[model samples]
Target chain A: MAIVTPGKRPGERVANSKVLGKRFTRAKKVGHASLMLTSLVDMFSIIVIFLLMNFSANGEILYMTKDIKLPSAQHGGQLERAPVISVSADSVTFDGKQIATTEDLQKGDVLNVPELEDVLREERRRYEQIHVNDPEHPFKGLVNVQADRKIPFKVIKRVMFSCNQSGFGNISFAALAKTAGEGKPLAAN
Target chain B: MAGAAAQPAGKGGKKALDAELNLVPFIDLLSCCIAFLLITAVWTQIAGLQVASSGGPPDQQQKLENTIDVKLMLTDKGYALTMAGANIDIPKISRDGAQNFDRKTLSEKLKTLKASLPEQGSITVQPEDAVAYEDLVNAVDTCMGEQLRNVTVAPMN
Candidate 1:
């Protein structure tokens, strides 16, 4: 048997009654905020995944040439944007400046090696500033050569030698997407 | 009186505690990423080239009325002629015959084929794997040398 307090009955205590309605209950306002945050986390995760997939897929679509034929290379190299030098059968041009031709580079022809080397060096400096400061940037040292099929290997060798002297090592050749019909032999101009 | 006192205590503290972990922000983020991925996946598959090798059957619609299938196999010596998979030996051209990429003979062969072709002449050059690059280049050059421009390089199957 338990003894009851003589001061007040447990169910009829006046102190509990006095404090009852005075205390305030906080409202469930966080409902909207929780829903908002849940959506945010979901959105960020999907973005991270999408970015990862996109960076990889970008590798294939990046280096395809629509207009020129690329010489087959024995050395496999990654395709990246490089300083483009377009060589037609008749002449060689760097950034639209016609530098030389078969006639201009023949034996006893005065070839401007120093001038060619200077231009390549300028390109290298420009590219380095744009692509090297940030570690994540992928456009490192690369040079794209768009040489015509008929351009003699001797002419290309000279250009390549100049490129090496300019301290730019990476190289890529541009080729036309194979098509039906007798493909045009690279013009010899 | 006792029930009235306990009611406010039970409701007041619990409401505030339930408000802490809001999920609204997280759901907003997920909606954006899903939309981005959907767009990218659709963009991945666009224009691409289809490559076909020579030695395969010519296109049915492109074939002339009576097409002659001349199979020229690149040998150590020179070109050997075949038709419908059977070898046809020409005189003075032995298995160990002239190994030089004889420009004269090659140009003559191309000229004959060019004359016999229907409106458009098509010759397929199938070179053996062991043939030197120079010889292959020479063979192609000779075909073109005779002004037989419609040619395709087909590897032997």
Candidate 2:
């Protein structure tokens, strides 16, 4: 009934115990190592890819306005340094000063000619002075406009026209940089 | 797998190995990142006139041509069209009629200015801070109507 030869029992029992111990230990180690490796590799690869893609786009400072929330457009790239100008929904600011209010800035708003002229004159004089000092150098200045994304094109045209008169030939609008974040906006500079 | 096959050879009954798979969490993370990149990529293309500068002796001579700049200042009251650096007088629209464009007078004035200019002349439109949107468009339309197509909305220098 025992199914074991009477003299072989002790030797067989010792051999089986040793073999089972070795096999169990090896299986435990392999399972732990492989599970850890899979996850560690997965996390690292994603991080590296996201960072590389983010920095490759254009180098531009984004101007955010309180009044305008620009809907994201599909076009993404880096823009060179031009003059930076920011227009809040109701006001325009350049070089850290309020240039015009919505009533002053909106194309539909009543035009205030003298004040607009004064601002343009001031901006132009500043640029001209900078260019005059370095005549040999091609001025790479651009007017970087940050306005409410929802404001109409007419307002943009008026702003552009004013800048053009002030002698800023280059203008660019600031957009949020493309990254692995949507509905969440990156901070604008 | 080899160990499991070898288990059946023992005197004891065959053992069982259990494994489960549900990859939902990993899939969720990847999808989030992909969605973010896709949505933010839309606003990337920039639109502006490319800067073109041709370097040569001829370009220098072209630059030397006496070009008069006409500045059209737009205000809420109306437009103050100026040229040769002198402020041009424009009659005010009554406050009640502030939004209306006196098209006939505007067109006539712009036409006269165009008639006096030579070919390839340029004008800088300077819209003031308080200019009405309709008025600015009217002014631009008027300038185009008068055949001054080489228009630049430049800031005052």
Candidate 3:
């Protein structure tokens, strides 16, 4: 059914015709969807800021293994790149290769570990050979030692001795930097 | 939001000045940044405690030998601060299985040593064979905290 109504003003019929034409044109674009991305953008922006704040420019070289747990330290400095000697609960490793067994190091009464010394000497020679010409960056004998907190000091003493005997005297002990929220580890351990 | 240049009326008014800002590409860029940052994030800081091994290469010697040599011995009991022909012992706190007596006695001894002898900057830590490795680290850390930076790890004499 259709009802006819007369226009009250002179231009009312023209405006009505123009509105009907626009409505007909808008009907063809109804399939397109506009997603409300305001909330998603807000969430992603926050995530980006949080991640950027925690990003580290210099990457860590030491591969933390499941067998070793480093002790936390309230005062620790930046770790310069050097040869790493990892002493876990069961074995001692140089870089990624196994050097000696824990039992052998524990039982031996000598001040220095013979196997560790040999490896360290070879490493020192390699470093010296590579830097033979460059006088500015001579071998500093710096080495980083990563050891489990529960290992006995006897093993550490021998390792230290071996490092010293092989000219790797500038030893640095690798540890986790302590934060404020974490409770102190057993002080006597 | 346009106020100064007003529209005449509704029928024949000026064109709308509002423009749409497309957020699809912006969100895409944010997503990529978040992924990259998360991949390179460092959860825990791995640091190092430096201790130049004494008796190293013989060239490190020939420093001032007259300064007081502070020797800290770490055993199962606690810390033993020995220097200048005097020994002060710090035993474990009673019944506190995990509490260290560092704050009680050793702190005072170390403070007095620091105040009395401002010149001594190094301390040799001698840990017995049975002592746990963490205790040695803690001992060295305590010494460093007390302004003794040049720490050395040596076996018990």
On lDDT, who's better, 2 or 3? Answer: 3
Write model 1 residue lDDT over A1-189, tens digit each, in one string: 799656434454543566752243234565443245556576677676866565444333333333333433211223354566666656667776867764555444322356667899898787768777677865434566665454544455456556656764444444333322334332210
Tens-digit lDDT string for candidate 1 (B24-64):
44455556556655555533221111111232224512656
Give chain B TM-scores in order. Answer: 0.47, 0.50, 0.77
lDDT of 2 by residue, B26-138 (tens): 55656666666655543344322222111111221233255566777665455677877677656554435334435456667767776776553555566554443334444
The Cα error of candidate 3 at residue A60, in Å, is: 1.9
Model 2 lDDT tens row, A29-63: 44343356458547755864674476434543454
Please name the candidate that would achieve the greatest DockQ relative to the true structure: 3
TM-scores of the candidates are 0.33, 0.38, 0.80
Which stretches in model 2 have alpha-carbon errors above 4 Å?
Answer: A1-38, A56-60, A71-78, A106-136, A149-154, A173-189, B1-157
Better of 1 and 2 by TM-score: 2
Q: Candidate 1 - CAPRI tier?
A: incorrect
Model 1 residue runs over 4 Å out of place are A1-78, A108-112, A177-189, B1-157
